[model samples]
Target: MRIGLLTEGGYPYAAGEPGLWCERLVRGLGQHQFDLYAVGGSGIPRPLPPNARVARTADLGGSDSGPTARNLLERTAFGDRRAARRAYGRRERRRFVEALHRLAVGVCGEHTAGTGEAETGAELGIAFAEGLYALAELARERGGLPGALRSDDAVRTLESACRAPGARRGAAAAGLPDHLAFVEHLERTLRPLSLDWYAEDALGAADLCHAAAGGTTALPGLLAKRFFGTPLLVTEYGVQLRSHYLSAAGADRSAPLRTLLAALHGRLAAEVYGQAALLTPGNAHTRRWQEKCGADRARIRTVHPGMAADRFAEVGEDEESGDPATLVWVGRVEPAKDLIALLHAFAEIRALQPDARLRIVAVPVRDPGSGAYLAHIKGLAAQLFPDEAAGAHAVGENPVTFEELGGPEAPTLEDTYASGAVVVLSSVVEGFPTSLVEAMFCARATVSTDVGAVVEIIGGTGLVVPPRNPRALADACLALLREPERRHRLGAAARARALELFTVEQNLAAFRGIYLELLSHAPVRHRPGDGVPFAHPAEAHVPGSWAPKAAAGTGAPDA
Candidate 1:
């Protein structure tokens, strides 16, 4: 069976989040053909698996489509236009306006009648779905939705919807500029409507459309399902809506824009979840988010993100190694990781155990802001350990050492995890805690703040404390450091759990079954020359009682 693997800012790119996993899946299932549809990346060179090939790639991040002439006659033509397109008809224009209004109302907040009778949440959901499809259908027919969505009419419609009674206060207070900005952003976000991937020769030809992430990536699958009856299987290792929320929370945008974008994302997420044939959340933490966003519990499955466990196999098997008094933190150094709090906790740990050491093994994230955050963390470390040297030093000399992953002391990821007895995660905000899981794979006892899926991933195998609690974090690390036996036990348990649930093999197996399961239930779209049943069919040639019988004197099978 052919699978359309859809991705956004990931996959088929060496630096993408799901690149490794997608590559692994495609390589492992060599029997199946995979067509990759990627969006928003450098299109940087990356090797493709033998069974997989690129179908189409679009740069949603502002790549030019080149110049084209716009003829007035073609632009003025109606639905029968063969060149450009006509403005929406009176009826179609009203339908489009009404749909957008309904969607906006659903997004901002539901309204009640003068009698206090309000539309049900289900009704609002219907409105959002209807509005989304209406716009999509309009784009299909008019061929100018990109411009239409960015027009003054769309902005005015959105503003009016926000000003309507029962709209959320934040949205109701939006200014003209906010509306204009939002409309422009919305047009880009909804660009999947203008894509030509829905034809029978494209995504329509696939047995199933597997979205690597939700939000933007899943939009194409939604369109595919809408246009060609293709089933959509959405897999989200890190929930896209949640990431948007975090980024919006941190962004220097206006309140109105934030509120409007949040509402839009909420409505879109609900629609996607409602339409998906199945929703696979990488962890239970993400599953809860999906459930809250209206994904049916029956359709939700927890598929843990797979990691290559073999790289850490030797480290995990060596139970007696690692410094008993050292605490390690390994990950990208960013403010979200809350290294400041980690430094504070380490200060407390040092006071309790004079010989205890902390190794902050980290690498900067792609964002330039992380460099400043890393410097701040370094300054905090200096102030916390004022007696220690101000700069880098040989390993084991400084009580608190800051180093990158590829430094002489830690040449590889496995080596970095092996450098300490207790791995620590002190982030106040987290999603799946990939670093914690890596620690587990290294068979290292973890002392992590309870955030995101850390508790779920640890599964009682390691210590979990409340986020931003320095005393708790310090105490947990101290306990693990003081008691070697408990640390060893937790490490062994964590390793077992990681191997059982979070390995590449497990992930491949899950997707392998999911692909077959979705395909088994999907409606088969028969094409030309498929042949009639039992007429020169391969099944008829099988050695079974139902096989065609041979004539008494002839060697050939009777028809």
Candidate 2:
């Protein structure tokens, strides 16, 4: 079956996020065809992954515009249902306005779990948002609407509603400033609905549309289901809701602005989750976020992102000599990785195993975060070992080697893994920690901090330590370093587990089954003027069982 793989800022971009996984899936399942849809700027110049082939690529980076073209962005006047007058009624508008007021300006009503009622102002705000989207969709179908949906009238209506006498306590306190902030944010947030890609000609052809990520990537999926009857599957490796909340936690926007944006995103998540046929999260953490965003538990599945399994065969062989003393830290040099802690831990390691070498590999990116962190770590290394260095230790000659995985010394990622006795991921914050998994594929015992899905992914294959505890990290590394037999044993076990669960073969097999299962159950709906359908389209006129049997028996002249 054909799959419409939708993505944003990645996939088929030559340098897209989930680039390798997409390629792996495509290559692994050669029987199925894939169409890649990516949205990002045009700076991507990397070569495609070996397995990922695209029948066609739909780019959403830049738009071609002329003077007469509509900008697609317009003012939103909440309660302006003039464009879609009938979607909302008197009672809905009143309830929505009251709830929105409580949500925006007042203390949000209590969100009493399991009850559909909006006891808190927050719940009320979300209710009001539902009315707004409902009205917008109605307007799109009917070609116009006002009040809680779209238009200058809706904005005016929203302003009046928030300022209404019976509104929630906080909403009743809203001024022109609060009103304007909400309106400004509303315009920016609702930009997804204004795109033309939602039409029949764009997203209708696919048997199923699978969004590789959420947020903007899922926007087209929403449209496809709206304009066409296309089914949608939204998979998020990192919960977009959590990211938004973190990003907006300390913004300069007003309380109402924050509330409105939150409500809008909350409402969007709700809508996406509700509309999606399936919701796949990469880890349990992200899965919980999906549930909190109102995703039905039955519809949610945890599909760990696939990683390359073939690259590690050499080191993973039954007989390979990997150092028990040498520790490898591979990833872009960022503060989040807590390299300082790693250095301090390395100092502890040096006290016991004097010859133990700690290699800090950097993956080149345009950002100076890597270079700056490398320099800072180099300075710390100097401070740590003040006795050694002068003409003896230059940049390249230092014991704490600052090598790039995609550059000289360790030319490739696989080579870097092969060089290390053990892989160390000392990250304080991580989403999926792909490098750790890659190391696992190479049959290298890892020492990742107890962050993200490290503990879950490790599953007793490698040693894990708490974040920012250099001493504890040192102890764990020392334990593995001291026991060469244990390291080899753990490495073998980790390699076995990675191949069983995290490979492209397993991912492809699971998805291939799901695709067939979804299609088999879904009734085939043929678009008008699309030629003869494979399904039986002929009308029936049978009087009884005997008549039907008689008709079925004769194909020539009318019996």
Candidate 3:
């Protein structure tokens, strides 16, 4: 089957979040034909996988690009729907407006488990909520949606939702800056609605539209079903909705804005689950989130993100040979990764074992904000370990060294893993925990803060610590440091588990079956003798809709 694989910021791009996984999927499933459609993150060069035949690509532009919407006329050749929408009488317009209103104001975010729609038959409510909006897209705009979805209406909803009881903590966003931001964000969030991606040429041709992440990516999938009776498979390794909540929590953005955006995302997720043929969350953690989002338990499948095993093959086998005194922390040096906390923990580890030195080897993903954060961590290291500055070996002998991967000093990933007795993660927020998996591949014992998917990924093979607590993090690292035999045992077990469950082979096999499974029960749309796809039925045409019968036979009915 030909697959139109949709992606945002991960695949086909030289640098994307799910790039490796998508590349692996394409390469592994050589039998399938794939037309990759990419939406690239700003400034990042996207490289297509060798197996994928790229159809189209769009730049999400930048963080500052104003709100976007897909204009229907520009995207579709819906011969009759345009007129049908314009001719919608009063009743049609009212129903459409009501659905749009409820959708915009629904109180939920990515984290809100959907109202238990399955047991309660709440899919109807979700359908009513989702269908109304989709129908509105096809619904006669009679007088053009009665002014709903306008800036003024948006302003009012923003006002009401923000002031409503149980508002988010950021509720104080009542000022001008806040209001404008809301308008800006709302438009961008709704951009997918305006796209013609749902049309047969874009998203409809595929057997299933699989969105790599939620939020913007799911929009086209929604439209695909609306236009072509296509099924959708949404796979979210890092819950987009949860990320929104976390980002909003610390954001200085506005309370009303957060509330409104959260509601919008929540409703969209519900609508997605309400309509999707299947939902695959990367792990049980994401699975639970989908279930709570009102997805049918039956439809929810836990498909672990596929990680290439090659990176870890060498590290996995030689688990016992890495340095006993050096503890390696490899990843981007971001504030969230909490390297500062790791540094302090290392200071304490030094107290326990004077020979122990913490080597922070930065893995450069080359993000926009990486420079400043890396610089901040470097400065923090200087203040904490002043003796390591340039040429000063002070009283305590600066025991921590900051370095970057792919540099002169640090060797390859295998070499980096070999140089450490333990791998460490100190992030306060994480998702699906890629670093932990990498460490596990190298069969390196790890001490990580119990955050995000650390515990989930580590399972039982490594020591876990509570986040932000330097003391606990220190204790965990030392436990591994003093007991070499224990580290070796845990490392060996971790490698075996990772190879068995997290490889590209397993991921492809799971999806290969899922694709067939979804296709098995899905309704076949094409009809023989219909000619080109989606051609209007002969009876439904207004006599000579396609051609003049006389030029062939009648000529515009003598008009």
Per-model TM-score on C-alpha atoms: 0.87, 0.76, 0.79
Which wins on TM-score, candidate 1 or candidate 3?
Answer: 1
Query: Model 1 compared with the native: what TM-score?
Result: 0.87
In the range 1-559, model 1's lDDT, one tens digit per residue, is: 7799997575686464577778888898876879998866555648887778888787776411221112211222322232212466667667767777777777777545565443466676787788888888877776646456655456668988888887878898888667766765677788888787777778977878999889988998998899888999999888888988888233666798788888788888988998899999999889999999989999998999888889899999998778889898988888788888888898899888989998888864677777888889888887888766554543336688888878797789899888789999999888888888889999999998888988899998999999888899999999999999999999999999999999888988898788878877888665443233243331122433342343233454332
Provide the global lDDT of candidate 1 against the true structure: 0.79
Tens-digit lDDT track for model 3 on 458-524?
8899988789999998898888888989999999888888888887788899988887787767786
Query: How many clashing residue pairs are found in candidate 1?
Result: 0
Q: Show model 3 residue runs off by greater than 4 Å.
A: 40-51, 62-99, 107-132, 135-179, 248-250, 365-369, 388-398, 527-559
Residue 305 CA displacement from its true place in model 1, Å: 1.1
Better of 1 and 2 by TM-score: 1
Error of 1 at 523 (Å): 1.4
Clashes of each: 0, 34, 21
Candidates arranged by TM-score, highest first = 1, 3, 2
Please report how far candidate 2 places residue 194 from its true position, in Å: 1.9
Off by more than 4 A, model 1: 62-98, 111-119, 248-250, 390-396, 529-559
- How far in Å is the alpha carbon of 105 misplaced in model 1? 3.1
For model 2, the local distance difference test gives 0.67
lDDT of each model, Cα atoms only? 0.79, 0.67, 0.68
